[model samples]
Target: MIKKITIVAGISVVLLATACKTKDLKMNAAQKETVSNKKEVVYQVFTRLFGNKNTSNKPWGTFEENGVGKFNDFTDTALQEIKDLGVTYIWYTGVPHHALIRDYTAIGISNDDPDVVKGRAGSPYAVKDYYNVNPDLAVNPANRLQEFEALIARTHQAGLKVIIDIVPNHIARKYEGKNNPKNVTDFGANDDVTVEYKRDNNFYYIPNKHFEVPDTEKALNGEENPLIDGKFEEYPAKWTGNGSRLAKPDRNDWYETVKVNYGIRPDGSKDFPELPAGFDTKSYKEHFDFWKGKDVPDSWKKFKDIALYWTDKGVDGFRYDMAEMVPYEFWSYMNSAIKVKNPNAFLLAEVYNPNEYRNYIRLGKMDYLYDKVETYDKLKDVIRGKSLPDGLSDIQNGMADIEHHMLHFLDNHDEQRLASPEFAGTPEKGKPLMVVSTTISTSPTMIYFGQEVGEAGNENAGFGTHSRTSIFDYVGVPNHQRWMNGGKFDGGQLSQSEKDLRDFYKRLLNFSLKSAALMGKYQEIQTVNRHETQGYDSGIYAFLRWSDTEKLLVVTNFSWLTTSNFEIKIPSYIMQKWNLKDGNYTLTDQLYHKSAIQLQVLNGVGKAHITIAPSESFIYQL
Candidate 1:
């Protein structure tokens, strides 16, 4: 059996490489070609809370407060709020239609189906249409396109970019049209009679069977004449649904979504009517003419035009939903098209495990993705004081591998909050642990709206009056009126504890945004084990980040008690390069405005010993 091996390194050596081999390894040669590209800060907003007039109406209400209305109103206050928070880009979630049927249950207006709706707004992942906005979400139903354009312009005016969600994997079942069955196309058949569907045309199609590996291989391999049995076959084939490719209802069970067909019509074919009912084959032909010889299906080709249209409309970028489900070719094509219209457009893929698929970076597929393994696995272990094989070295390496951008967060909408003890010990310990993890990680960070405010219920927050995990407090509403009247008022009313955490977050965000060393590429300066200090070897880790112009050292003690008489060896290169004559350096506290650098050298080895409190984190700058 072949085994996979990974190499992890300590911080001190990593920094030494940066200092000595600065020019040799600035960025990969290909990445160096694009180093002039500017980095952006993306602030993800739950659109309903930010400004959805149909949802609520208070001070932070939906475009109207006490009957006063303004044009392009929803974004006016919300943009100002985010701009104050120092975010450069705004990522709006769920701007498109939620469901095609308009059933109240789909949007949480009714709570009949727990699987489909649980008194919470449906997951925006279930897209109704690629081309239309949700009517309920729009300020003006008839002028949605104009209103959306105005929203994009307003965001740009605020010196912020905009990125809307794009769900390419599946379209809502109802949106395919009422006449269409869940599996069969509107023509009462599972497949359309495109050239790919005709046996004589050399395209592969599966009979009766749902998507499977054999069918997919046949389509991709361009088999002349492929046949398959239920048992293992000598040759396999790829699958391509004629015109019914996009009409497939069940995304979870389908393999075609993993590798969509990219077939072109043959030689000036006109008036091909063997398409699924309600689908205009002529329109598809006209559209396919734009791409000419592109091998991908007509449905997949539409994405390029859609992306370009939005880019030209001033939408900055896209966060591809379930990006891995789509092919890399699609991402490359869409990214190129988006960049053509807006060069600075930021594309972040919702990839859960990026480390396993790091090659996607070179394809220009995504600028950033959610780093789940590091945040959930490694960070979780550290806070719990478990014996990690390489201690915090794994985190240091993970930070280094993030080539373009990596979003650092302790919790997100899809997962349980880090505040939950099931993952990070206890809320009391988890809060500080999260603060340290989110702040110190060498990636652009993201804080879910309610995280800083300590909204604890991890259960789904209802859309109506009985929400357990309400974001009303974060949106600045009184708890009494927020729950009773269902988020009616919003003049920045917050509980004392919520207010304290919010203030801390504001300070932290401002500090982080202002620091180039934190956002820029990092070079680890040092790492220390616990034996060097009195009772320090238990559960503590220290490291540093330095650029040519700036240097920062971070020390964290993940214990529940005061660490007494701990000594750490300072790297000789750092000591000599910084020119510390007395074997000591100035310590500037990043969290609290405090400064202290006094230390005694042991036998001229340039080692310093200090005491740290429980759950304490310190940052020293040189």
Candidate 2:
């Protein structure tokens, strides 16, 4: 693949020098936590959209109408400022060269038919070239790869790691790996297309079937796609990315890409070697050496070499997309090989099946998986004021065995925004939600670029809709643009309320980064309180986190219309477990330092008379 690593120099820093967002950020009142391991925090930014300056939010606009963020936007000074936000890693989304509707034929890059593309800028997950960076993200499209490498170098210099996406389950239908290594071959170069399935073929094919365009295509209805003649010529049609075998896939399906084969037969039987009976109990080292000399399928070797190639270029890790759809065996082979190259690499995947959680984490050698089904979904219920915290404690208690392997987040590119009407209508609703997400576990926490500033994803970007931020179209984000502040990286245009909300997130995230109690131990005191007394209600939740160096009391009110003032009782069992004696101590709210409560250890049971406002949360450091 095209591997060009360059370090850019002499970028103008006039805008950065004027930005003063981090000048007065001094979080005090909480004791500085010193521990062996601290919690990790992630800042996920859509690379193509983070630095955009255009305000023309016209739906279905062309490139000239809506501007895209360039790599130069993330200058050395900007990265240093971002590092000051207490983030350990930055996930740069939409980094790869994907199949966009734009034409770069002058640079020897072929034009993509608009009939199959998602939007004017296209979907980043539909990768067109695995080796090259997206042309839209570079000032000079011909040197896009160099621009990305410079970004990686700058991030490392700022004391932050970088992560990119790796979509293995599928690729753009018109796949081409530019500047591939001499030893490497392009996907489907010599595949046996006549057969429905083969042990070594890269993709599945249908015998003697010609691929037809979906009837819902705008071009099919005469809206015009210059290169599309309402047909895609394939003697034996390949299966759609979502596993649809029809000659004409439904418009709603993943019709822009084709599925990659990994030795699975048409009947869903594995053609590769499976791990032994007790292999789940084996370590990643053993798993790595197991595939050292074994002959593997072509697809497996291709993906493994692809991952190692990027790591060798200085990328820290990958955020695998739709990992569950790919074979579990392929992950075991791929992830083990990845860890061998860099043992400290952070590998995360999006796996939704609770039943396969253990298998993916243990045998697949994945580091973290999205806790959407159990943690995020159940929390949304509480936000809607529907159910009592039925599964909140269970999610923490049930997954106690593997809680560290889960990543927590309230806003992401694929989910609805906190301020969206379809989701939570107000930014205040996210205040308590962020506390529960960050402090309830020892896992990593992530926030989207505009989440703290309350960017409601209600834009009319083409081909992307509803609640979440648009990944396909080039549209300006109103709220995030205020924080961008004319490329100053300062909240110059934000209202006082917005600034206060951001301050709350800053304290919550910064405290999470340094707290030993957060990463040490967790106990849901709400469960015991539910059975012991009437003070704690369904709208309130309480928990305790402690270690040898720190003791933390956390409580949040989920209701937006009610204020909860009650005495939270720590049961005798917890008192004995924490080695409490009859004494009085002070507990200060780390979030705002607005109140200090009288913590009593009398009668060998701890009690704290606390008052929480609507959508307010506290992390008291004792």
Candidate 3:
């Protein structure tokens, strides 16, 4: 038998050094408390595509042709390898039973029309059943739920938590809940479809109008299917998921789904009760009490029940899709109920509006929200030379109150790959961004599965042909497949650059996971350095993170082509905080440990003359 090469094999030395240094630091009571609060590192893998070994990625291919991965594919060894990468939660995306075009009539699943589905596999957001797992991911379609339960159990055994999606904004256009429990009924089952909006109704209806599919040729995307007839039967058309009121929604709209009415009328008026003043500062238990005996919307109760059901089934958390589109009041009721069930549940939301960040965190009780518009967009511009790195300081400082509630990521299922030609043109450019984002604040770090292996999701997989990995089709990720290595969970086929990239992630994530300073005080030093240092310009970003015991000087060079030699200084206030006098202190890089650099302190100021390679970053430990 051939030896399996784990992701930890190359970076074991660096991790060991980090562990030893952590013990050597003289931590105070507060710093020790901060060290105990370990930072979360989320590893998001599209469950359907994670274990598929098939490389025959035919465009618009059926499950049989492309070979869909099953629940059994996440074997113990595969999960252990993921755990070794310093992941705390494995977000098993696309686990819910979504609308797909496959025929499962043998087991009571209705065939969906291609006109109403995004691709042959369909979008994961358009859920058909909330009570069951996707049959496509099970060896036996009838026992799909059992297979997923086993996966949840196996994940717990591997010392990791699990997170799944709960899209509150919509449901599939053709929802068939054959697996719903006896106590639970299908959405819109008791709806009065004659009315446009009702407090008790599950969906908003367009009375006296019939549902019409989009243009057949455009919906099919040049794919041949027997069910593409440009028709779907409905007595009254419902509002599209994106709030489109048209009987036939446009091709760009969320046409595969219908919006779930949360006591909001069509005239931009809310029918739900607004949370009272000072409720934002209340605890989840208190918020849970506030909704007691209140006549809440029917959709709110149904989604809350769905969330509790999953909590009972060992699901550790949820990732709410398009959270901003839904009302914050509904989130208060729903998330409060979830917290009452599992206080430790990881509740993450995708709220992009900068103004609503505090409302979602405080009012909605969300544990984390996507830091996309500010941190992610600004960092992308910095890498492309369109924006300066100093701009990040303002964004971080602006959200300092809720910085820990913001989750950072370079690539996700919705975003373009870092290695794609349209993005950075190479994964090497992500090094500086990764270091800065990971160590910037107390926020949690998220990494999509193939990001470590440098996967450029540029494949033309039918309906999804952008630089992003297709969540709407059956396709294989080429770079991820190399690391899969025939289910050995090893990097046997990874190139040298891929191996190096993966090693860098392993070191940085592991260090971030245990470092006390990451969860401590932060001060951006980029502006001060630009004015004081000769070579330090907008192309360079610098910051300081410290606790009672440990201090970290983080610097990254975003310039893609040239080496930057700059003189970095620790300010007088920070020197006073550390109580340093005129002497030389050794600063070691946490990621590479290339060499020990010297920081000289004179007149209550510390300075280090540094030369950094293009796209290189260092987390210097003092």
The best candidate by lDDT is 3
At residue 492, give the lDDT of candidate 3: 89
lDDT string, candidate 3, 186-212, tens digits: 899999999998988999999999988
TM-score, prediction 3:
0.94
Q: lDDT tens string, model 2, 98-125? A: 8987778888788887677777788998
Note the clash tally of each candidate.
Answer: 17, 2, 0
Question: At residue 481, what lDDT does model 2 achieve?
Answer: 88
**TM-score of each candidate structure, all chains considered together:** 0.68, 0.92, 0.94
Please say which candidate is ahead in lDDT: 2 or 3.
3
What TM-score does prediction 1 earn? 0.68
lDDT of 1 by residue, 1-622 (tens): 2222221111110011123112122345433332223334566655544432232322222223212122254455656656666566777766765542123343333211212211123445555445655544455555655677788888888887788888665543223222122332221123343323431222234444443232222221231212222222111222322224322323233322222332333222321222223222122222233334545444444566667656766777888876765555455556655654565667777776554345445454356677666655666665555544234555656556454456666655555555554555334355445544544544556665455555454332223122223322122212222221222323255666555555555555665666544544443333444434445444455565544445555555555544334566656665555344554444555555554454444434455555565434444443
Please give the ranking of all candidate structures by TM-score, highest first, separated by commas. Answer: 3, 2, 1
